[model samples]
Target: MDQYKYIVVEGNIGSGKTSLAKMISQEHDRELILEEFADNTFLPQFYNQPERYAFPLELSFLAARYHQLKKKLTALPLKTFVSDYLFDKSLLFAKVNLKEEEFGLYRTFFELLERDIPKPDLIIYLDKDIAKLQANIEKRGRPFEKDISNTYLENIQIGYEKILSDSGLNVLKINSGELDFVKNESHFKKVINRILTY
Candidate 1:
């Protein structure tokens, strides 16, 4: 576990990746790198009108993800680091959100920048049922997320599963649909222990 730096805690929108990453970073004094989704001005519009906004939204996210990872990841020559996402998240969401033509263009751009970004040494996937995911999304009370559909989330989940399985990176998939790592100290400790054993 000590040797595994650059750990990524990844999941769908409401799967609690940020919370878990924060907890892990705080507990272990690792650098926490969270996705700056709020910086994407296209997000709210995309959720409202995906067909009209998908291309730009994905492109914006792709740029942001690449830039952030390049900046923060470059700093970690040693010591533990945890992030709420993987750079491949852009690819996953682009497939779900973009048209075929749009994704083709996006993929070309993605491939260009991907080689320069740092890959995670260990990726911990937190899986939750769609129902629970929706519940958590609602609990977060983000206005734009209120419009997010179950079908869309399901598609994202499916794409995520495929990408993670085929990622060719070190990954541990956890069935965390029932656990609340946020409020429960026991659950959080258990998660930490599992990560340590990795």
Candidate 2:
């Protein structure tokens, strides 16, 4: 378990990634690094008008992820770190949100910033069905997310899977539609045990 100095929990927008990461960090006493999604000024606007705000929103997220991860990972004495998101999530979202020409421009900057990111030792990907995901999203009751469609969520799901397949990192992909890691102790324990044994 010590071999996994850095671990990342990933999933679609409404997946239980943040909840799992929080629990793991609290129970296992690992350093937690959560993505500052609400801080992105363009996120609400992007949700309302993706075409107009997509580029800036993506760029903002890219810069934020790079800056936060670089600052926290390098300067902190975090032996075991659990983050809600992977750094390359910027690229994944950008690929989906940006147009071809815009993505080409974004990719150039992403590659340069990506070279500086320290890779995670293991990734726990929550693979949930779209129906469960939408339910979870609705339960959260974020206004910006209310407009999110199942098709959009599916696209993000596909994007996440594609990246995981190509990431070449030690990954544990779990079918998480039935697991309630946030409220169920047994389920959370199972997830924690899996990561530790990995």
Candidate 3:
């Protein structure tokens, strides 16, 4: 944790990546970068009508993520930081949500923007089963996320597995289904120990 200047906690929707990232940043006294998903106007529309909104939703997200990271990562007296998302998460979701031709075009834009962004020194991937993920999502009670199907979540999980496996980045995968770091002090300590030891 001390050696890495930039760390990312990544996982599917409702897998508690944000919560874990926040806790780590607060505890470690590092800067925190959380994804601004709620700011995306296309998100709700995309949920209801994916075919009509997926491209724009993804494009908006790409631009937002790039701009946010560029601004935050550049405005430095450079302290170590933890973010809840990896920049390539855009590509992962785009691959799952877009058509073949749309994805090709999206990938071009992504590649162009990605070269300029600094990659995380380490990525902490939280892996949870579909049932657990769904329960968490329901617990969170975000209306836009209420309709997310198990199949969709399963696809995202598969995408994460494939992407992380092929990515040359340093990654730590955690089985988070049984861990409640947000509430249980022991669980939180276990997670912190893993990161510190890794």
lDDT of 1 by residue, 8-115 (tens): 999998999999999888988998889998868899998888899999999888888888888887866766789999999899999999899989999999999999
- Give model 2's TM-score versus the native structure: 0.97
Model 2, stretches more than 4 Å misplaced? Answer: none
Report per-prediction Cα RMSD to one decimal: 1.0, 1.0, 0.7
In order, the Cα lDDT scores of the candidates are 0.90, 0.90, 0.95
Clashes of 2: 0
User: What's the lDDT of the predicted structure labeled candidate 3?
Assistant: 0.95
lDDT of 1: 0.90
lDDT of 3 by residue, 56-137 (tens): 9999999999998988888864688899999999999999999999999999999999998998899999999999999999
* Per-residue lDDT over 1-198 for candidate 2, one digit per residue giving the tens place of the 0 to 100 score: 677888899999889999988988898788899999887789999999999999999998899999999988888855689999999889899999999999999999999999888999999999999999889989999999998988888889899999989989889988898899877889988887877776
Error of 1 at 170 (Å): 0.9
Query: What TM-score goes with each of the models?
Result: 0.97, 0.97, 0.98
Q: How accurate locally is residue 44 in candidate 2, as Cα lDDT from 0 to 100?
A: 97
Q: Give Cα distance to truth, residue 187, candidate 1, Å.
A: 0.5
- Which 10 consecutive residues of model 1 have the lowest summed lDDT? 71-80
Please identify which of the two predictions, 2 or 3, would achieve the higher lDDT against the true structure. Answer: 3
Name the lDDT value of residue 98 in candidate 2: 94
Candidate order (lDDT): 3, 2, 1
